[model samples]
Target: MTLDTKKNVFVKLGKFLGQFKEENCIKNEAVFGNDLFFEKFIDLIQLSQSHNGWYTPEQVYFSIQSWADALTEENLSQWLSHYDFSKVKPKKVALILAGNIPLVGFHDFLSVLITGHDVLVKTSSNDQHLLPFLANYLIALESGFENKITFVEGKLEGFDAVIATGSNNTARYFEYYFKDKPSIIRKNRNSIAVLNGNESKEELAVLGEDIFRYFGLGCRNVSKLFVPKGYSFDSFFEAIFEYQDVIHYEKYANNYDYNKAVFLMSNFKLLDNGFLTIKEDSSYGSPITSVFYEYYENLDDLQKRLEDENDQIQCIVSNNLVKNSIKFGTTQKPNLWDYADNIDTISFLSII
Candidate 1:
């Protein structure tokens, strides 16, 4: 199919997704194929948590809404406008997706197909249902898509290139396994926020969204904090107190209890606020229900350190205190053009 044909199909998929909200799922007759797929989609959303405890309805709905907002005609045009697709000789692009958060690998899936290439998707065991469901929807929107998308159950072969996302360990294996083929192998990375003690209570409160959204499973979730020396966390703790309801979730509560016990047994000093714990750690990746924090004496020195270790970080959230940092609370609401790990997928695909 042509690029415009592919784009129009996804735009329709976006419109269908827009009907489902956290509060309600309102059906619009104008959305194509809703009569067959709409009710089934709702059922799938409801059943998501049963399949994977992390895939709660609220989290799934948030992911759906985010993609709905992203796949608009305008957003797709802006993201794809920078690439010249004439030179893209259609090839089979294999995707090995990660399932830490709902629909975590959709961007790669969309990227491959929209560029006029066939896709071989091996869905993460934790997220096998949602994408296939949407793939079926896409096929319904355009019968031609049926020929372009395939879900592999065994060994992945017949693909020219691969894009794999996994932990640091898996990345090593991916590098060796796909050594001969062109590939993008993603490793574990974490997001961090820098605090200057000048942020408003409102901004701090919003930062809680960055911390708690998707239960901190996403690479975009702020898992660490950089605060100046002698920084008082009273306001920060108070602002984030609104998210205490997270502790009511059994899985999260179990993690909070377990991690807290481990820390206590190790005699690690911690700042506890009933639900979340803040520990003075030099590391970026934090466990669930907790965030690691480090004290910085100089913004310039800290920026330099972060730049030197850029591969370990996904995003830097701040009040523009550091160069190229994103604003508070917007880490999870990334635009279509915001490529993960600063790697341009389009450029990579264009070459391969």
Candidate 2:
């Protein structure tokens, strides 16, 4: 396709996705029943309790809005700070997804669709409703969309490039299998925060959203925190206490109890709010095991620690760190320019 074609694709997609409301996406994601949109997304996150690849409508809304916002200059700029966009282009692509997080594969799907390439996607069973459901919604947005996209459940042959996401272990498998193909193999990554004691009740409230939204189950979710030595966990805990409503009955209760029991059985030291466990560790990504937090002596040490662990860092959710940086509610939501591996997604699409 030509540049005009690519531009037209963007025009159609923007118009379609721009007007998209939660209700529409709710219908798309639901199997049946009253619009359980936010509830379903919440269930997904609650189910994140078991690493079952779920999400609730509220979280999905946060994610989709983040997705919508990501296409433009605002969110994309922070991403572009580290990537080069001049080389992006559309290429025949195959995307294999990870079932760990809700719509973990959608970023690759959107990149392929918006970049003006034919996309063959294999959905993760944990989130089977996502890409196909999103495609159904995006395709219905306009005529060209219906024509531009295809849904492949298993696998596809003939591809110039590949984009796949999985556990670090699965990433190794992806590398060995796709070694000959130009690809971006996204593996496991953990996000964090370096609170400098300036956090107010309002900011901590939003941080509460970041941690609990998906039950601390996203790559962008700060499974850990980096506070100065002797940092007060009380400041953060007080904010989390306000969200006491999220812990009602059945599944979430079962998850809270099960994980809590495991922690008790193992004698793992933890700071508990009767809902979340703030344990300290150096691991990335929460496995429904427990949320880990760490402390740093100063900003320089924090920067060095993150830099040294760049391979394991996905995103940093903090305020007052940089001008246009991400806040708590915005984690997991990525912009178009925020390409995986800091590579320009659109430019890559335009090139090979």
Candidate 3:
């Protein structure tokens, strides 16, 4: 099969994805009502809800849309900084898909696709559906992309370079197994927010979107916050309160009861929200049913602390005009430009 230059790959891939999102691509005459073909994400959102997390229907729609858009060659081209792919040679690649959030496999999939390499995906059972669906759609529009990617449900085997995303515990296992291979074995990362006094309530509400979207399960989700000591909790709550309707009271109430009991048994205290529980911890990300936040007395001290822990943070959200920064409203939706690890993926592509 001839490799289409990145230019052609981008355009065709975009067209294919655009076509895929439209309602007509699906054909299930047996069931005429709202279909999971597009709405399959409701299952994901529901699974998340069981753990007391939040996911609006719109958020799920957009999340799937995000996956579709990012997997395309057009998005991949932009991610590679519009580099000409005709210049690179195909590289061998193995990608261990992460099930932590929706479509987390996309980055690795896009990287391999744009680099003109074969991708072998070891899918997580919790999150196996999307990537295979995507490959089939790509096959429909661009057989080359279809043929270039492969999906497997088991452990990954041989490859020149492997990229694995898993919990911090699994990183050591990945390292031990793939030591002979050039690999990017990523450990768990949590995104954080460093709030100053200037951010308005509306912005904070948008920030809530990030925390609630995907139920704070994604690596890009901002879990910890650094609000000014005197910052109004009311302002922060007001902004985030718009999402209150999504509080899945039953699930959250249960978790609240369970965790509260555990805390009581262990002699712990948590500020309550009728459903969600908030506690203080140095760790950024928490389980869907929990949120741990620390109140800092000084900006300089907070900055020093964040700098020390920067390696564990995938993105930093703030409303302040900090370039390359993940601001409040923007955390849930990352553009084509925000590369994981801020690595110049195109530069890597240019090399091979």
Candidate 4:
């Protein structure tokens, strides 16, 4: 199929997704195939929690809405305008998806397909249902996609190249195994925020969204903070108080209780607010329900450190405290052009 045809298929998928709720889903048949697929998708979204405890309706809907916003004609055109795909040959790209959050691997899936390649997807067991179901919708929209997409249950085979997302340990295996193939192998990375003790209350509140959204599971979630020395977190704590309801979720509450006890027993001093904890630590990967914080004395030194440690960091959230920092609360709402790990996926697909 042509690139325009591929874009049209996804735009329809986006419109179908637009019917799903960030708050309440409303059926709209104007979206392609929604007359038959819309209500069923709603059922799947509702049942997603049963499949994975973390895939709550709200989270699933949020993921859906984000994609709905992104897959617009304008967005797709702008994102693709810079890439040259004329030399692309039809090749199969095998995908190993991550399921930490809903549709975490959708971008890679989209990339392979949009670049006019077949996709062999190995859906993470934790997120098996959603993407495949959407694939079915894509097939329904474009019968040609039926041959273009495959979900593999066994060892991936017959793919010209591969894109895989996993933790550091698995990354080593991927590198060794796919070392001969053109590949993009991703490793675990976390997002962090740099606060200058001069942020407005509203900005701090928005930062709370960055921390707690998706229960701090996605790579874009701010798991660590860099605060100026002697900065008082009183206002920050007060601003994030709105997300206190996250404590009611049993999974999160259990984590909060357990991690709190472990920290206290370890004699690590913690700043607590009943639901969230902040501790002084140097690591970027903080545990769920708690965000590690470090005090930075010099902006120049911090910038250099972040530059040096870029591989471990997925995003930086700030009010321009650091170069190319993501705006507060916007980490989860990445544009279609915002390549993960700063790797240009389209360029990789074009070459591979």
Number of the top-ranking candidate, with lDDT as the measure: 1
| Cα lDDT of model 3 by residue, 24-48, tens digit | 3443344322243335433544454
Residue by residue across 15-114, what tens digits does model 1's lDDT show?
9999999898999999999999999999999999999999999999999999999999999999999999889899999999999999999999999998
Report the alpha-carbon TM-score of model 1 versus the true structure: 0.99
Query: What's the CA error at residue 158 for candidate 3, in Å?
Result: 3.0
Q: lDDT of each prediction vs. the true structure?
A: 0.95, 0.65, 0.65, 0.94
Candidate 4: C-alpha RMSD after superposition: 0.8
Report the number of clashing residue pairs per model: 0, 23, 1, 0
List, residue by residue over 241-282, the lDDT tens digit for candidate 4: 999999999999999999999999999999999999999999
Better of 2 and 4 by lDDT: 4
Q: Residue-wise lDDT of candidate 2 within 1-352, one digit each (tens)? A: 5434544444444433343455554333322222533344434434543544246555555555655555543433443355443566545788887765566676677667655677877777777665565566554444576766766775667777888888889999999999999888888777777687788888888877777666666677777777778888888888878766667635566777888888779988888887777777767665453567887776766676677778887778777563224777666555555555555666666666
Q: Each candidate's TM vs. the true structure?
A: 0.99, 0.78, 0.81, 0.99
- After superposition, candidate 2 runs with Cα above 4 Å error: 1-53, 68-90, 137-148, 319-325
